[model samples]
Target: MGILERLSRLIRANLNDLIRRAEDPEKIIEQALEDMRAALREARMEVAEAMAELRKLEREQQSYAEQAAAWERKAAEALKAEREDLAREALKRKQQAQALAEGFAQQVAQQQALVNQLTTQLKALESKIQESEARKALLIARKKGVEAAETVRRFESKVDAHSAVEAFDEMERRIEAMEDKHKALAELDRNDIEKELERLDANRQVEEDLNRLKRELGLA
Candidate 1:
């Protein structure tokens, strides 16, 4: 019946529609802002139309008042000129004009009230849209943060400590084998050196024995 009533219904319907969708928070906030903007646009148009209608009603009221005054003067002139029948007719017309003027006055008051209400609603809708836009930015930041955390989680899950340990164990075994081979080579070298020294010592001992024999067998 009125702009205020229609605005209330639209607001409720938008909220209910959002709830029914049950979507992501970011999406929900975005949709809510769009709905508010649409509602604001509609409210502006309604207020404009109501203001126009109110102005029209005021003009009609003024016209009716002027006609009533004119008819009243005509009625008085008829009475002064001794024409009761003409006076009665003019009086009836005056009353009718007065009644119509009063009706337009009432309509103007009602329309003005509606226009005021629609304007207030439009402002409120603008305020809500501003707040929702800020919230949407915050929501997008939070969603990005969540995505980054999920990526880190996936990377951590793919890394395996057991595999790293197995790789190190293989390298360690290869080093141990190399060390064992070096120790074996060093022991062989030491043995070879000791045998050569023993051979030299034996040769020196034999020479000494031959020299003693020659000395004992000598005539002079």
Candidate 2:
């Protein structure tokens, strides 16, 4: 309702509680800070207006007081001149002016109180805004850090390290099996070449022995 009441509500708000209850804490903090700043602006304006009103009241009280003093002096002069009716009229005027002055003085006191209250509320709201701004930054940063950590955790959870290692081991085993098969094929080819060479050597020795036998028979 009142500006001071609104400021008090804003100052009393629990930021941490709001953040905890919010689904998006960063957004909540930002909104809360914005609200505080808005309230602070309004509060400053209210305090300024209150102070202006207080000043106006003080000026009116002073003016009325001066009028009362002037009327009193006129009453004294009329009395010295022995004009009893004029003196009575001046005294009445002085009473009226004094009453007005006193009324303005009372108003000034009330306005001064209002101004003081508004000023205090304004200062409190400013301090709250400052604190909320600082906390907003810190809270946003912390929320980001928490989100980053959660992302990393989700990624880690999705990727199984044991499964990755097992896949690598399986691939290595397949490659080693291929290499063993190739080495066995090479060994078999070498054995076939050795057998062919031995067979050629045996055939050549048999031909030479037969020729020697034929030469011995040619002597007949």
TM-score of each: 0.64, 0.69
Residue 90 in candidate 1, Cα distance off native in Å = 1.5
What candidate 1 gets wrong by more than 4 Å, as runs, is 1-22, 80-82, 160-220
lDDT of 2 at 32: 72
Best by TM-score: 2
lDDT of 1: 0.85
Clashing residue pairs in candidate 1 (N, C-alpha, C atoms within 3 angstroms): none
Q: Superposing all C-alpha atoms, what RMSD in Å does each candidate have to the true structure?
A: 7.4, 6.5
Model 2 gets an lDDT of: 0.83
Worst 10 residues of 2 by lDDT: 11-20
Q: What pairs collide in candidate 2?
A: none
